[model samples]
Target: MADKPGNQTPNTPDVSESDLREMKVDELREEAREAGVGAVSGMKKEELVKALSEARSGSGGDGSGEGSGSEDDLGAGPDGGKIRRGPESSKSLKYSQEVTSPDEEPEREGRSLVTTHHEVIKEWAEERGGVPATVGGTEHDDHLGVLRFDFGGDDSNLRHVSWDEWFKTFDERQLNFIYQESRTDGNQSTFFRLENPGREDA
Candidate 1:
């Protein structure tokens, strides 16, 4: 129905020129060879047509116009469409320029895991601060609460106080974790777990 790409031959039985135009490029090359159009690859389009005409008309000669290459000749495999994968950089494990050894208390540890700090907080408060927490009411579930906060630029401090004591002393409506960028409603904020020491049932 459509004129595709192809070459014309000049050494075969009589064939119409319109038929040659309708053949595909690959198909025309094949026709030239079958019709004895020698050195078909060197001929120009016009020459190929002329040769094919002469050959088909019983005048023998060799000239066929076969294309040099095709669109599919270059890169038609998985590499053409594939996206390669590479190693991903990790987001955690941030490191500091300053370095400090384990013996440097209240100092910097350049690249340290955080779990060590939580454990240290629990231990130090129990040993030095007597685990004293000033919390409010029976909210601590019988356990004194130790709230860790980092008041921006004031240094992070773990305050071990009773839940009831804290609740009573500070208004829950205006309290917030020191490190949080946003303000917490004092009435709605309290991180302490006030435990009932005398109760056994849930």
Candidate 2:
């Protein structure tokens, strides 16, 4: 049977010595970076191997080799998976809102979550380019054609929802507001909160 990542002991190396020997220096450097060993761009293969070895050992072989950065800082779950959020720097009350949690698995899956940076979307919109999307066309029902988001870049990756459907779900989720960010497709992506719009200072 194939071994699980958690099966490795601290003493056991994740990458075999033979594998490290076969990997190029660039590959070694990338491995070091993923392992969160800094200053590896100039490192030789042997140095990279040692550094990565240490990182793997120190990480207790849980498969996530992330170093000192907090999970919050990395914007990932404890398992090093991406969280459904936006960039850390975003803080606009105008876009502030809570996220609606959907079902675990739908009978029919919807579109993947939109992960493009909001800035990119805005730029695309300003350029007069819109993401190609469809709404309300299904086996059970069909509606009029394509929907585009002038300022919401690449809604192609996002599921389409009618305003009525969206508002219903939104209210059900009790989202009071919404916000967005620039870093959307990486370990660095984040979710920010906006100040309450009702505040006089806001």
Candidate 3:
């Protein structure tokens, strides 16, 4: 006797390492959490991919996997992978300097500074009369869709949001804020952009 479609067991494919590698770190972390992997918050992208792969393979008992307990395995930094703070003088982020604190000065006028620090972001926005906001109609259920700073603009598309909500989404999305302290002419500029290193689309 043939089984009904509703009663039939679906063949769900196992998540592969290659597939996991294609996903962003945040997405992988969510997968790990759903797979019962512990201590996920501290894991790096590579660590998350490894753990999720193990869990899906059924070889990872309790889904803790291996190498997930040590601080080194978690990440080597003061931010513990949650926040990235540094000068980022590296050539990879060409023309951009890392700013870890609100008090840090830009390398020079018009020099772009990048950071994941909440304080720096907040200070930069507030200094320009900008407030935390999200694009209206861009929400996914209770989750915020797109983040923006509204400088008392007349645009009705922006919806005001609490700093807490903005930061929560920012961290969750693993975003970096890039902005300039001043223009080349040394004037206060509102130039800013958001970037996600994990996703090409971002």
Tell me, by lDDT, which candidate is best.
Answer: 3
Across 1-202, the per-residue lDDT of candidate 3 in tens digits comes to 1443332222222655666686766566566767777656556678777877777677663546455444223221234223343343234356588776544688788898777767567656866778899999999999997999999979999999977788788877777777887999999899987777666555
Cα-based RMSD of the predictions, in order?
A: 34.6, 16.6, 19.4
Which regions of candidate 2 are displaced past 4 Å? 1-13, 59-202
What TM-score, to 2 decimals, does candidate 3 have? 0.56
Better of 1 and 2 by lDDT: 2
User: By summed lDDT, which 10 consecutive residues of candidate 2 come out lowest?
Assistant: 102-111
Encode model 2's per-residue lDDT on 51-136: one tens digit a residue. Answer: 77777668522233334233113221122221233223233322323223211211222212222222222222223333323343
lDDT (10s digit) by residue, model 1, range 1-202: 3352232333335567776665544355446656676544334455556666666676754422234232112121222211112232112212211111111232232222211222222222322223434323434674434333222233334454542343333222212111111123322121222112222221
Residue 161 CA displacement from its true place in model 1, Å? 87
TM-score each candidate: 0.24, 0.24, 0.56
List pairs with backbone clashes in candidate 3: 87-98
Off by over 4 Å in 1: 1-12, 63-202
TM-score for candidate 1, please give it: 0.24
